[model samples]
Target: MSTGKVVLGTVAGLAVGGILGILFAPEKGSVTRQQILDKGNDYADDLKSKYNGIAETLKEKFQAVKNDAENIAQSGKAKFDEVKNEINRPAANY
Candidate 1:
């Protein structure tokens, strides 16, 4: 699934679990709230790290493809120039 869908699912699951815990627990409201906040922060950090890694990989792939296209264009131009020069050369007299 896409990153957005994964993130949404994670958030939804966390919310549901937190609600269940608060409903069933004998702990104070403040303590449960703090726990949920801490867990959510950790999950956010994990997702951020994953996103950065994916972005870096995509950038490298893009650069490689761009370089290959440039090289191909240069090769084509060189061949065209060589053919043009050959055609423009003086013809031999009989």
Candidate 2:
């Protein structure tokens, strides 16, 4: 979530920065508009790539945590069964 927010903020910053920079440039109106459009598209692509990478990383981490929890639960269940069997064993006759 935080990574998504950061990417959003970055794209916003780039857009604002590009607009401001283009506004001050000496180019004609049509050329400036085109430049801004191109820049916006580039920034959009960058944001998409970054967000996808973050999503992949998060998925991997989540899977790892889930696997760890399952292993711990299995170990605990095995230990309980061993203790239970030991307690239920019959006593030897005299």
Candidate 3:
């Protein structure tokens, strides 16, 4: 699977395990709730960080591809111009 999906699955598993563990702990209800809240925020932040990293990678890859395409187009145009100039030139005297 893709890296994004793997990261998302891992984060989700961690969040579920954390909440379950907290629920089974001997802490008071108020403390348990607080822990869950904190864990949720932490997981959210981690997910956001992973998402941003993936987005940046995709953007960089797209830019590289775009640059390659532009270079190829320019090269093609240059070749076409060279051929056109050759065709339009006068034949050399034998």
Candidate 4:
């Protein structure tokens, strides 16, 4: 499997396991519920941070790729124009 899918699956599994553990603990109902809430919040924040970082990285990479493609296209156009000019130049007869 791809690394991204693996990471996502692992995170999901951990979250589910945490919730189940809290639910089955010997603590009082109110305490268990509170613990589950707190853990859920923590996991959500962690996932959000990871997701934001990944998104920012991808955004930056996309911009870089776009700029490179633009530069290449411009370079090719300039070369094409140069060749066309050479072909159209008037040549003196011998």
Candidate 5:
């Protein structure tokens, strides 16, 4: 149902269909085997590239969230410290 799933299904279907077509075509056994091997390698490389891209995007998103959390924590701590200091001050200092 998701876009990623649809795309993956479509790609898988296309690869399977292409390999089947090549298998059924009239050709020398060696040639047919070579073609299948070439196609498989190409598909593997493409999948690896896509995986790396997705991994990089996830890493960037994770880093951004981590930075935001750190900033929020620092801000909260600074406010707490300021309040504590104020509370401990002498009434004459107010």
Candidate 6:
């Protein structure tokens, strides 16, 4: 499995376990609910961070690939122009 998937699964498992433990404990209901809510918020923040990082990385990679492609196209065009110029040059008189 992918690292993201693994991390998500682990986080989900831990969240569920925490909820179960809280339910079984003698703690007040309000505190347990608050803990669950806090954990959920934290998980959401983590996911947002992960997604943002991935998006930034993907954008960078796309820009790099686009730059390389443009360079190759420019080089090809230059070579074509050079060849065309050579072909069009006048031949020496007999």
Q: After TM-score superposition, what is the CA distance of residue 85 in candidate 4 from its true location, in Å?
A: 1.6
Residues 47-79, candidate 2: write the lDDT tens digits: 789878879999999999999999999999999
lDDT of each: 0.82, 0.87, 0.91, 0.92, 0.91, 0.86
Kindly list the per-residue Cα lDDT of model 1 for residues 1-94, writing each as its tens digit.
8977987788778767876876678878898787778777877787789789889999999999999999999999999999887777644321
Number of backbone-clashing residue pairs for each candidate, in the order shown:
0, 0, 0, 0, 0, 0
Estimate, for each residue in 2-94, the C-alpha lDDT of model 3 and write its tens digit. 976887788889999999999999999999999999999999898788778889999999999999999999999999999987877755432
Ranking by TM-score: 3, 5, 4, 6, 2, 1
TM-score of 5: 0.89
Q: Give one digit per residue, the lDDT tens place, for model 4 in 47-71.
A: 9999999999999999999999999
lDDT of 6 by residue, 1-94 (tens): 8987998898889878877877788878898788778877887898789889999999999999999999999999999999887777754322
Question: Which scores higher on lDDT, 2 or 3?
Answer: 3
Candidate 1 off by > 4 Å:
1-23, 90-94
Which structure is stronger by lDDT: 4 or 6?
4
Model 2: residues with Cα > 4 Å off, grouped in runs: 1-10, 91-94
Positional deviation of residue 72's Cα in model 6 after best superposition, in angstroms: 0.8
Candidate achieving higher TM-score, 4 or 5: 5
TM-score, predicted candidate 4 vs. hidden true structure = 0.85
**Least accurate stretch of 10 residues (summed lDDT) in model 3?**
85-94
Could you say which candidate leads in lDDT? 4
Q: What is the lDDT of candidate 3?
A: 0.91
Candidate 4 shows a clash count of 0
Query: Of 1 and 2, which scores higher on lDDT?
Result: 2
Q: Candidates' TM-scores?
A: 0.71, 0.79, 0.89, 0.85, 0.89, 0.81
Q: Write the per-residue lDDT of candidate 5 for residues 1-94, one digit (tens) a residue.
A: 9967986997798789879989999999999999999998988898899889989999999999999999999999999999988888866586
